[model samples]
Target chain A: MATQTTDVGQAVGGAAKVGMPQLDFSTFSNQIFWLIITLVVIYFILSRIALPRIGGALADRAGTITNDLAEAEDLKSQALAAEEAYEKALADARAEAQNINVLMRAEIQGQLDEELAKADAQISGRTKEAAAELAEIRNAAKANVKVVAKAVAKEIVAALGGKADAKTVTAAVTERMKG
Target chain B: MATETHGEAEAGLVFHPMDQFQVTPLFGAGPVEWFTITNATLWMGLSILVIFVILVLGARGRALVPTRSQSIAELAYGFIYKMVEDVTGKDGVAYFPYIMTLFMFIVVANFLGLLPMAFTTTSHIAVTAVMAMAVFLAVTVLGFVKNGFGFLSVFWISSAPLILRPILALIEVISYFVRPVSHSIRLAGNMMAGHAVIKVFAAFAPLVLISTGIGLVVTPLSILAITAIYALEVLVSFIQAYVFAILTCVYLRDALHPHH
Candidate 1:
């Protein structure tokens, strides 16, 4: 079938009769001519346009990757620093709370001590006043007892029908109390 | 492709494997003039168009995150660039575009030729020879320019004993001159041989229709063989292009550093 299609062109000269078409020198010039044109065209396309564009693209990609990696590294370091600052702030807040607790406890203790001292002084003063009152009552009772004794004696004497002087009776009662 | 070969199905098994490689005009049954737009021109032109599409238009989107075709373009560029740099060293990076041109052309052309009934342009000696010769001449001239008369030291073996140096030099000189020949023939031969072998196996595919007994075994075997060979050919296509480019770099290296 290939021969049938290509068979149409064998009607030229007797020199076309050859075992291999590759050895056919007649087509060399045509092949070489076209080949040169093709090579030159390809060369220009590659050198002037295609290769440089590809190289540029590859280089551009590499540069972009490098820049991105560097930026990522910078962000990572920044995050670490921020974490350190946060930890320090937390520790500072805890220390401040501790200081406030100690100060508040000391201030409360001072107020309690002052209140207790005032109550103790009031109790002692009241006790002394009560003791004085008690002593006065005892003295009054003792005087009353003597007077009653003298009155009873006078009544007895009157009942016996011997009317005597009050002065003398009082003197006698005083002497009995002394003895 | 199966339909294309079916035309000769009725005429019994006919094997014209070499006919696929013939260089004929795409238009009429006329002479293949130097300027004539033959099948060779069609395929070569197609190769150029493909290169333009893949390397130029395909990679139009220069995205930081690449699209499919854009990545393909970058992959090809890096592959060739690395090859040239590895084989020819840093100074050879200047000629990266030229080496890239050859690599892209051959690689794409070879793959295009893998299509059924498609003309394999790299299968021709004329085409591969021209490319190899271009590399050879360029390297030779660069050697002379860069190293002056010291370029001849490439063939001279300094490490060898003085008694054996002449013999080593003689061998090196022959091998140096043979670079272009081996380089061109190797690519063309691999391509031509693979395609011809496939065609031969394809011719045997219709054996089942002719005779049932032997055709059962021969037909299936040939088809399987075709599959296997086609797979191998695909590998060969890329490898051949790689071999060509690497060889070119090796030559360039020798030219640049002509010593040990």
Candidate 2:
């Protein structure tokens, strides 16, 4: 304080002669003291309080960003897996639909083939019965014609008053029929 | 008083641009006492307060999503941290707070000085010199404490020819000691010159009345020059602070690894 007072007097007396106060030695110590105090206070505040909090905030933000990215990646992979499963399900459904179509076609074809076979069997049975009836009618008519021709021969013989053998006539008629 | 009237009668224009830098005792016209608070002290204190508000109160939320003030605080923190990490490497990280303090104080002081009628504390060599000297002393002490006598190898250029080694060493030693002077002067000089230029241009405003229509042309042009210089000074303010911090980091790097 004593030195400061002496310097204070020198500053006041020399103030008129000084060209630039910055060069004045009397005031430098005071400026230096304040500078030190300011710097020290700022250093403590920055180191102890401000810088650490800012650093923490930065680190926290970084961690959040990293976590969000990881979660997004996980969700993306999950979406891809779900898409793959959906495609698989779609393909299975398509295959099942195709299988059903093929089975229905085959069953319908089997039923159509069975109906055609039943109709053919009934037509063949009708055709065989008509052929058998025609054959029997022809046989009965031939026998009737043979019997009538013999009776007419015997009558003509009697009407001529001649002695004719019935057996011979019958034999002749039988021989003619054979030819 | 008669000389002033005579000077004005003769069309003489008087202006003292440097008078603005005078450090008068804030309370009285008397001599500045050791404990006497001056404009420099007030501005310096304001710089500190601003720093505190921005760094402390601004980041009070510490929210995951930062507010504007929080973002500003984070930006300043990240900017200086990255600069230190890049310039001085991991070894210099320990001194980050000191470097940060210097950068914040200087930048704040410079910007605050731009206010009309406000004093620029950093414009004085007395302020910058102490800061530079502190860095120099701390680095020098750290170098010795860490490297012992081996720190002296910083001056010895082993890569040189044996005959030229002593000459190179002497040059290196001279440059090494010149660090603080150049460091302090660079900031102080830059701030002082810019402010002085603006003041000089402003002084030309009143010369208009004496020079017929010349003042008309000079006044606007002077304002224009002041505007341009003020813009440049704003840039210089930030740059000088960055330069000071980066240079300190470089010096610290040397102290940490003196062999290189």
Candidate 3:
């Protein structure tokens, strides 16, 4: 600390003249000197090291964010491609199933049509043979009737008390059969 | 309370509110020679040391996910950088370091003063004027250096009527010269007034005991006023620092684009 006299001397010399010490011009150079010193030091620290570090941190964060977003976008596009491929595979499988069903129906219909055609041919051949047999039986029956008629007429004529000729009886019987 | 008042009585209750601002040589008994270390110098140095510790050492880690101290340092850096960039546009960003230095010094000095028994160097015109004058000189020189004789057009009002152009130019020149005066005074005045008001209220804290009955009511009231004013001064300190820095940016903007 300064001696009382010197302190008083300085105080009276400068501060006392001006009501406020701030208005005291005598101390301006000292304040200015320190101000310059402090400012210069602060400027160097901020410019050289402190500011650059902060700027680096900010730039790093922005780069990381951009990189992450790009990766996420790539992943999203890949997922979309996979989904499209899956859908296409599903549609292809459905078309194959439909094709198989149509082929089986066509094959089964061909087999059923072949069986029906064979059965129809067998029935038509049996009806034709039965009709020929019927016609032959009818002709044989008519010939027998004529022979029996001639015999019966001759016997009747003999039993009656009148003589009967074989030629007359045959002629009458032939006429009647013809009519 | 009685003991406190007793101490005050023994020390003589005369309160020298302005005594806190007095500049004294810190060392030997002598006049404050140009180089003599003084209280003002000590506090100014302390402000610088505090800023260095917070910004340089605190940011040494420089983590992606920053520590608390690192976060503070980064925040201050970004805040001033953005301010300078926005106010003066991209071209003016080159001066960011200087502007940032001014902001840090004033803010630190203002905050340091809030400490008990601390000297507020920023409250004096001596300190603030130097900074303001520096801004003024730097801007003026830049304006001239960049624009040559065309720099005088900043004061000329070409848009005004022909008859009024000369008169407007005169007004502009006067206002331009007043920039440093207003800039320095605005900060120092605000700081000094707030501090002095707080001190005045504090001085009254002990005055109540002189009146026996009134002491009970007045002492608490005085304390309350001190609390209120102290809070206001804290806000004032931050605002004044911000104002000084931003105004510097505005002036820098003019230098870069005088047409505006």
Candidate 4:
């Protein structure tokens, strides 16, 4: 077995040195050439193929982040506008309420003034009518008293039976009454 | 004698036929021999082709909801992106392609090496050294392009207190030059050591009957170790690639901003 193994080893070693076909370049040169080739090939693959995809992915990520941020900003602005509108509506409602209050107060005051004026005029007319009725009653009372006094006086004179000339008697009574 | 028996004992073990793949010089070649493709190169090429085809096909549809292939592609992309971002910050996105490619290629190569009867291209010092040199050159060029001569300020310890300037500057320059050597050696040594250990451990399985049984037990253990090491290699591959890329970025940064 040992002899067989040695024989196989020797044969293999011999074949490697002489019997095998050779190539153009030295092992070192071949390695260098292959290394260069590998480098160029790799450089080509990377620059042409892989990098562009990675760059695109990175750009897409950046763009997505930027878009999301912009959208958030837009939404914030819209919210602010909506809030402002809500406040304006509230203020308008308040202003409208105040205006309605002022108008209502003015209307109530005007109606009150109108009623007061009407009452004042009625009171003045009633006072004037009461004064005129009192004056008429006083005049009628004076007239009645004067009629009764005159009739009584005439009856007395007839009962006393004193004869006199009409014109002289009338003149003497009027002069006595004047004195 | 005992040595001969020991040698015989050592020789009784078997390995897969393809395990014989090795880097050997051509017969009658001079010190600088003619260049030729080895099994390692073939495997490396196949691995590269496989990775490229898979990625290309996976990315074909490029749908919104990813297909399975697209998902795999996207996952790889995302993983590398996160890695870059973690290492170099968001600005590293500019370098995403280069870093990702480096990571994928290294990972696939390491994974391929884990297969039985497969060649580990990364185990070769020449291969790893060249890769490290390429990184070094690219970074150096980037530095110059970005900052001109001002990039040399990274090695200038005079930027600190004048008393320690010479020593510190020497140390910095030495460390800087050593980067490529260390980077290459770290990867290549790890791969070579691990695979050699596995081969040696496997060779021990046929010595004694009890040892053979022990070998059977330990063989699976060694396989498990190999798998673990392979996984570790995968991690190291990514880490080394990342380190290379990030250091390049750092060097570039220094070039771009000298005071930093």
Candidate 5:
């Protein structure tokens, strides 16, 4: 405790110094020798253990950072790929929907066309039958008119005091109608 | 100015700032032997222990997300590592451990010295000189071994004009030899000067008890100066360590690539 005022002194009191202790040649070897030993010990400890450990820690941090960045980049690309696939799928679904619409429209049109064609066929057939029936009625009416005219001619001849045969009257009437 | 007696029956203010640098045996007062464990040894050993705890033990977790102490350890490691790689190039990374050892030791020793009444090991010329000399000798040897005679090209600046090349080489040689001396002195001088100045200011702080008249002015001023200087010393100590390490890198670069 008393000698605590050595160079690494605990003593704060002023003890007179002779010349410069640094310039004092007697203590040079002691300081130099100790410094050498301190340095050697430090060098060995650092080289053997401390330096490598610290260096490895730093390197490990860098590697971890790099790996984390790479993983982030990879995830970003994957997200991009997923979005692209979703867009493609969406586009495909839209196209399929349009295709189904076109197919449905065409089928409905074909069905409508078939119904119109069948209706046309049925109407034409009914018109032809009706025309034939009108022709028959016209013919019947003409025959009836001719018979009535023959009867009337006969009655008129009898009333005018000129007696004639039924066969003759019929013949006359038929000739008139022909003219 | 040295000690002075002011009045009878009163202890005059004593300020022996240089006395703080005196080397003495930690055990007992006697002649310091070459192997005697002095206060210098105690502080150096303490610094090593500090480094071990902060670096070796602190980084033991090897966490991807570092804790506070681990962060400091990794920060120092990365700072010096990047500096070495940048200044010394890729090949110089192999000497990172040695450089880190020097950096940690010096910086830790310097900060430890700032503690009240603690010995400043790095302030000693003997200590810094050895480190600087070691760097110098290692770089010199490595240069010679690696480049052989080609290492001489570092001194011979072929980029200069023919006439100036010899002069420049002479200058380069002198500068190269002076590197160790300047490197060591720069750290030691800065540490010693700052501490001594603080001690000087502290010695004046007692003026308040001695003479209340001047003490009123000198006491506050001296105290303020000590505070300010103490803060500056903190910055200086760290800077000196960084300077020393970076300078080592520069020297290593020259050795590895002596041609340029």
Candidate 6:
């Protein structure tokens, strides 16, 4: 019975061994060595080359931003100057127009006054000439009338003979003119 | 009937690829038997090749205004710069190359392992242990170079009272030795556990199919779990890489300043 149990035990142990895979360690050492080597090489590259370039790029970006901002400010100042000049020119033009209008109005008014004066002077001269002609005609008419009256008076006096007094002669002359 | 079922179940369980890749002796040689070119090695090689190509291509044009490749290179450099600055302050600039290289290498290796049929080197204790050991050795050497015998004072807790100095020194020494072990295990354990769980769930997918409608439901669920785990692994890979780099920086600090 003991011998039988031992055989059974051995059978069980053998069966157990069949299912299990053996472990391997050589692979572990190889893995460890290569991991170290790779890490070391990576360290070398990063330290020697990559980092400095990144730092330089960052600095360059900062410089570019600053330059762009300064350029923008300069353009703003130039725009402001242009705006000021434009406004000044507009104001000057407006002021010049006002001055021209004033000068033009004064010259127009002076010319109108001269024309009015010349027209008045010509009218006055014509009136004076007409007045003088009227005066001469009146004088001539009066003289002719006086002569006729005198002739008439002389005839009446001859006819009247003894009624040749001044008052009576005057009264006869007025009665003849009335008829 | 249950005993028979249990026996059959036990018999059906098989050793997986992960078990086969474990750090064990082959053919009864010794611990040295574990050394071999494996999936982990392949992934690591691929990682190096990829990084090398990217850097070489990125740097080739060298234009005054950056091209796309140059821009990518600059971005990577800038990223590392910020990381170093945050971790080590302005003095970190001097060590920027080392930390950046370390971060990229580990990140690529971790990401490569996520590919189908790829080996994760960071998943093995032996591999991660070796890396941590390298860092420890480098930092130790740097400490001695920079501070000479003064570095030995770091273990003594010089700020403590004289009475407590001896005890603090012993504790500090022990903690120092534990650094490499913890660092390696932190990365390796996370990777191994995550991958193992994924494999186990995947194996269940087909087994659940041996049943009828239940198998169909379980299989989809298993697949979904696998997908979720994959996403988590990707996240963990990045986190581990960051942790490793940050820890390396801390160690470098220790080297630069011994007492602190």
Every candidate's chain B TM-score: 0.95, 0.93, 0.92, 0.76, 0.95, 0.80
Best by TM-score: 5
Q: If scored against the real structure, what TM-score would every candidate get?
A: 0.83, 0.86, 0.80, 0.62, 0.88, 0.67
Stronger candidate by DockQ (2 vs 4):
2
Candidate 4 chain B lDDT trough over 10 residues, lowest sum:
B25-34
**lDDT for model 6:** 0.71
Candidate 4: residue A119 Cα off by (Å)? 5.2
**Per-residue lDDT tens digits of candidate 2, residues B181-236?**
99999999998889889888887766666664566788789889999999999999
In candidate 6, the residue pairs with backbone N, CA or C atoms under 3 Å apart (3 or more residues apart, or in different chains) clash, namely A25-B34, A25-B35, A26-B34, A26-B35, A26-B36, A27-B36
Q: Model 5 segments beyond 4 Å from truth?
A: A1-16, A148-164, A168-179, B1-11
Error of 3 at B260 (Å): 2.8
Off by over 4 Å in 2: A1-14, A140-179, B1-12, B158-163
Query: fnat, candidate 3?
Result: 0.64
DockQ scores of the candidates: 0.40, 0.43, 0.38, 0.09, 0.44, 0.23
Tell me how candidate 5 scores on lDDT.
0.88
Report, to 2 decimal places, the DockQ of model 3: 0.38
Sort by TM-score, best first: what order? 5, 2, 1, 3, 6, 4
Error of 6 at B63 (Å): 6.6
Which candidate comes out best when scored by DockQ?
5
Clashing pairs in 5: none
Total clashes for model 3: 0
What is the Å distance of residue A87 in model 1 from its true position?
2.6
DockQ ranking from best candidate downward: 5, 2, 1, 3, 6, 4
Task: Look at candidate 5 and tell me the lDDT of residue A126.
Answer: 100
